[model samples]
Target chain A: MKETKKILLNSRPEGRPGDSNFKFETEQVSEPKEGEVLLKTEYVSVDPYLRGRMSDAKSYIPPFEVGKPISSLMVAEVLESKSDKLQKGDHVVGMLDWKERQVASAEELRKVDEDKAPLSAYLGILGMTGLTAYLGLTEIGKPKKGETMVVSGAAGAVGSTVGQIGKILGLKVIGIAGTDEKVEMIKNEFGFDEGINYNTTDNMTEAINKACPDGIDVYFDNVGGEISEAILFNINKFSRTVVCGAISVYNETSLPKSISVQPFLIKKSSMMQGFVISDYSDRHSEGVQQLAKWLQEGKLTYTETVREGFENIPQAFLDLFDGKNKGKMVVKV
Target chain B: MKETKKILLNSRPEGRPGDSNFKFETEQVSEPKEGEVLLKTEYVSVDPYLRGRMSDAKSYIPPFEVGKPISSLMVAEVLESKSDKLQKGDHVVGMLDWKERQVASAEELRKVDEDKAPLSAYLGILGMTGLTAYLGLTEIGKPKKGETMVVSGAAGAVGSTVGQIGKILGLKVIGIAGTDEKVEMIKNEFGFDEGINYNTTDNMTEAINKACPDGIDVYFDNVGGEISEAILFNINKFSRTVVCGAISVYNETSLPKSISVQPFLIKKSSMMQGFVISDYSDRHSEGVQQLAKWLQEGKLTYTETVREGFENIPQAFLDLFDGKNKGKMVVKV
Candidate 1:
């Protein structure tokens, strides 16, 4: 094909990103150069943390340049190769372009085993998402057996995985999500002990207190808003809070306001820490090995909300902020 | 003496505490009972943490009951010993009443050496203040040599000690205090690299950025409010913050407001944890030994603002919130 389509960050949005902020364009490309493989994109991962990269502000990750193809984690297949490390028909994953087909360097791609797990598992459960849940929970959360663990954004990819790991670690896992559907999924599918739908709950503090009578010992905070305020009020003494993402406040045009957490933190002598998955880069293989073992042993489960085609990638990304996807939001290109 | 005068928590204050909230009462006692020793107060320690106990709110320590003598850490002389573990004329430190004389259990008092250091040094440098600074810095801050460590409330007992320990560990110490006098004391007496007077500076963020050009790596937070928010904004990526106390908010009747810190924490991937000195109770001897050795070797220097007589205890405690004392505030009886 002479034409290839890709999504570009046309402009940085002031608040929540829109379709206008993203510009889609087609370009002509020949084939893979020497030491590069022509990869056909199979799955594109849309993560909430990507919103941080959209702004020019300093963050753990660099900002995405305007008028360029937005790059993210994706699972692909080797269609053609000029590199000795990769062969045709091999499955792979890398920070490839949002376009359907692109030439990637051999070192940039990691070969994935399709027979051991489905190809999409490389983007959700057995990939960086799963590792993110594992490292943040075990390293920061440090949940003890029989401790109560509460996770916000419990229906999302990272939150859901964190809940599963919390259960396997023998914690009483409670999840906070936006919708009734998400609440049902968290309790039934994700195996959470209880779920509070923040959208319908009249009083979050009372609801949280009811769900977590023992008080929250380890709080995996994925959403930072009123829900977090409630969780802060309900933390047990010496509790630990692992701040993985703040999807609720990521698109706020103004400063997000809530009850100050310092007083509660001081009274309870608690801890709160934020980290990205890349901080655990050296332990990636270790995390992946453990996650895979859990998956193969039936101790871990995952869900992926897959949309069809490459053109829908931007919408999938935007839907994450709206809490539209139940689990990992991936696009089949 | 058959009668002893001591301070009492008359009632909970609305905002900042005053003399009316504290009551001076005289209590009658016969003599020392079995396993109890008579202790005459030499120096009664007044701390910022005492404000937490004055309120009915839940805290690390129980609130003082109305019409009861408020008890705290005090350096005393054993006047009459009924226990074999203690002897008359022995100087000791214990959680004793703020009075001229009292009876204490043998195990309640730890014999402090007046030969190694001054009688008052046991309440300031070689005591809980020093231990709080030691453990919170070494255990939580975990700062490296040449890293920038910013301490708020730098003129106070705990913060002054923290700054000194930071220097001993080869860190670039920057202190934030309320007055020009304190700023000078932090820089000159404590040997800090820089000091920012929060009282004089209109723009804290700008002032902090000017002082810590390399950005803050470790922050030992003794006062939390705008100062803490400013520090959070200027923290380098992967910084560590030790929340020892929040004196600034201790007097606020409403929720203290500043820019939300969650975004900054997330962007920098930083860590913040709060703690009480007693959290390291099991390792008290470890901290006391190091502090004593530091004092004996002349590696550590200290100052104490002493008020003579028992009736001045409430005023001395109130002065802590007003930032009147340069170092530890103690009542000498």
Candidate 2:
């Protein structure tokens, strides 16, 4: 038996999640069974979407059960393998529990190349985040060349990748970020055509109008609320809005209200669609190949805000709400 | 010379439009020039969407220019024709100025067979109203057979037709209307599977949940306020909501606030699309052919609340906001 640390959901969060919501416990982990592999958790991805699972509300994915161990995408090393598919010391990624060591079925995890890209990239640009940005942009947004595209939460993992892909697709990519530094980073590093600091800007509608003189044809929305409402005013005819994530209102205890989107959508003959990454699982290989090609050409780049140690996982997740991470927030153990 | 009575948009209304916003005047109508035809207005179609054009707000169609004659779909008799395309006394239909008698280009109007259906039918079921219902539901709603479809403003022209179409397409149709009589009418007259009188219901969400026990797979929205907000909660995964109209908020002077749709949309992985009839102009003939076939096969029927006299057109248009009309509201000139 191996001693391992695992985090449990002590209680569901009312609004903003804190340390009280999580309880770290020491446990004895057993060896891998017949078709199982023993995994040592290396990198844990902490995202805003986890907040939805923390609540008991109905959602695309079921809410995390209270008093049970919390789970998310984790990159791990196969320390012991009872399956032929995975060898010892193989690095793998999958939806794994928040534990230092655990045994999982071979089918539950896919091996990743250690030399090809960083292990955490599998949780981000090379995995769910990358596929989400590409598929949502191409399939839903349906962006055309020379069309103006606006991205909300532009400095974050998905937003930055979406903007970069928009640039690659020959769209005039404009990004909206919370900070001036993030705004500059998206424009300068991510190759965005322009950026708006939503925090510093007065009258976002006016700012968006000035930034996109021809109006927005595609909007990849991550931060929905007032920013999304302002973007609605500047949408052109037949615009497509990809509703990716709403980090802004994810933690609201009560029902959040905003200007009705129905009127704006009607006026412009526009469409807004929301999707989870799993919806496009059938086309994952296609997405992975294209993303891998872009990465090889140095056309696609990514950033990571890695937090050290397994004990800090809960705090890393809480930081996502505060916008403390520059890019993908990952806890390395 | 013909003495034509024309209604001019005197001024834009702030909220609810009244007689003060329209000015009636008598004018001399000139003879049709070389490619033009002189038309005598026979039937005038007054619709809720006209309210959008009455205000100087940005919409799919431009706001009617103030101090100019407002126009809509009209069926008229060809009084005199200078072009080979039309003959005298031939009934024609087109978007024409709100004038009793006027001259228009022969190309502007299409000859309609008066013997096949009532002249007024061209302005309702055989015209824009029917096409709006067909295209909006099929193209945007994308309803799957055996799916549950809930329609708001279910007693109005588009809503009534949408519910009927949903039934024809093999969907379980539920309708929401203001009055209990309308709720009964949609179920008994329009052949909807279920009905909910939103005005009588204490909690629309619970009522909708009970009505659409399987959850709403398709929502054809015409009202788009509290009713729509209630519908949002009961949407099934991958649901499609066609935002055909938002008559409830059409007359609002200020921005209308409601529950933010982004969270619900994201949670369901659904889509909401808004479209005007003209967006599918290319598919109009297909829509008309199908509607005409259905009408002739005794599978389809329509209702029109006809108000007599040309001068009452403004009041007829105003009555739309009050839910005074059952289906299509038309005026005989």
Candidate 3:
């Protein structure tokens, strides 16, 4: 038997998750079963949606149970294998529990070629978040050349990719974030046309109008609530609004008060659509390949706020809600 | 000169338009120029959107000038013609002033044949409001068979047509209205599967759930305040929300405080599209013809809430916000 360190869920938190929500436990890892492979976790991806899974609320995805190790998109190396599909020393990315070592059935993992990109890239830009941004902008947003696109939570993982992709499609990308630093980073480094710091801006509608002078044609919304309502006021006729996430109002015990945008929809003759990445599972490979090509062509860039050790996974996720991470927040377990 | 009684703008009201906002004045008809025709107004259509036009705010259409005769979709008789296309005694429907008789350019009016449907039906079911409901549903809403479809302001002109069309497409049509009488009318007369009166219902969510057991697939929203929010809570996966009008919130000085529905869009992977009738101006005839075919086949049914005389046009328009009229509210001038 080999020793495996696991981060188990101790209890659910009231609002923002804390260290007490998780406990570091040591367990014995046995040999792989007939069709299973043993993987040693290398990197764990922390996302905003994980907070929803922590609670018992009914979401698109199921909730995580108490006393169980939190599962996330992880990059790992095979330590032992009995399955023909994977061999020892193969690096892969799959939905896996937070553990130093664990045995999973062959059906649970997909082998990744290390030569294509960095192993950690599989957990960020070239992974689910990146794919989500790509497909959402192309498939639903339908961004066109010289159009104005406004994205909320623009400094975060998915929002950053969405802004880059909007620029690639020849759209003027305007981003909205919490802090001035993050806003500057999104505009200067991420190649966004402009960035609006929500904290400093008293009138969001005026800020959005100033940023998007031509009126918003495509709105890639991640952080919903007041920001979304503001964007609605400046949308051009026949605008497309992609509802990717609503991190701003997700943790509220009761529904948060928001300005109604429904009337604005009629005024602008616009559209607001909601989407989850899983809905595009069939086109996952297409998104991944396109994003991978963009990365290789130097047309796209990504940033990760990496935390060391498996014990920091909970904190990394908490940092996402705090708007502390500039991009994808990941843990090197 | 021929004498005619016309409805003129008396003054703009501060809240909820009233009869005081209009004044009936007698005017002598002016003779048509070289390329114009004298039109005898038979049916002056009173639509909810006309209320928007009375204000000075920037909108898709320009606001009506104060102290001037209100302009709208009117069915008329060509008493005399100076254009090659039109003749004396020809029935027509066009954008015209609300006078009993007026001179219109030949280019502004389209001939309406009484043989196709009732001449008044051309003003209600085969007119702009009817086309708006038909095209908005088909082009934007895209209601599918067996899907649960919900329409707000379900007793109004567009709402009634939307519900009937939803039923024809094999949809389980659910309607939301302000009063029990309107709710009963929608269910009994318009063929809606169920109706929810928002005024009487304690729990709107529960009422929506009961009405739409499978959840709402298509929500054709005409009223956009609290009713729109209630429907948003019950929308199913991949739902399509077509925003036609927000009659409920149109008169409000400020946007309503409500819960944002952007997260639900992500959960359901849904889309909300706003549309105006003019966007499909090129296909107006196509919509009108399709609606006429359905009406002739006895597959679609419509009702008209007719207010007699041109003097009552302003009151009829105001009656829309009060939910006083069922079906299309038109003034027989």
For lDDT, the strongest prediction is 2
Candidate 3 CA-lDDT value: 0.87
Q: Write the per-residue lDDT of candidate 3 for residues B17-48, one digit (tens) a residue.
A: 87888888898889988889999889888878
The segments of candidate 1 whose C-alpha lies over 4 angstroms from its true place after superposition are none
All candidates: TM-score of chain A: 0.98, 0.99, 0.97
Which candidate number would show the highest DockQ if scored against the true structure?
Answer: 2
lDDT of 1 by residue, B70-107 (tens): 88899989899999988999999999877787887898
- Candidate number that wins on TM-score, 2 or 3: 2
- TM-score of the B chain in each candidate versus the native B chain: 0.98, 0.99, 0.96
- TM-score to true structure, per model: 0.98, 0.99, 0.97
Which stretches in model 3 have alpha-carbon errors above 4 Å? Answer: none
- Superposed by TM-score, candidate 3 places the C-alpha of residue B69 at a distance from the truth, in angstroms, of 2.3
DockQ ranking from best candidate downward: 2, 3, 1
Pairwise lDDT winner, candidates 1 and 3: 1
lDDT, candidate 3, A134-182, per-residue tens:
9988888998899999999999999999999988889999999898899
Residue A16 lDDT in model 1? 92
Winner on lDDT (1 vs 2): 2
Q: After superposition, how far is residue A175 of candidate 1 from its true place, in Å?
A: 0.8
Instruction: Give one digit per residue, the lDDT tens place, for model 2 in A253-333.
Output: 998999999999999999999968989999988998899899999999887899999999999999999899987889999
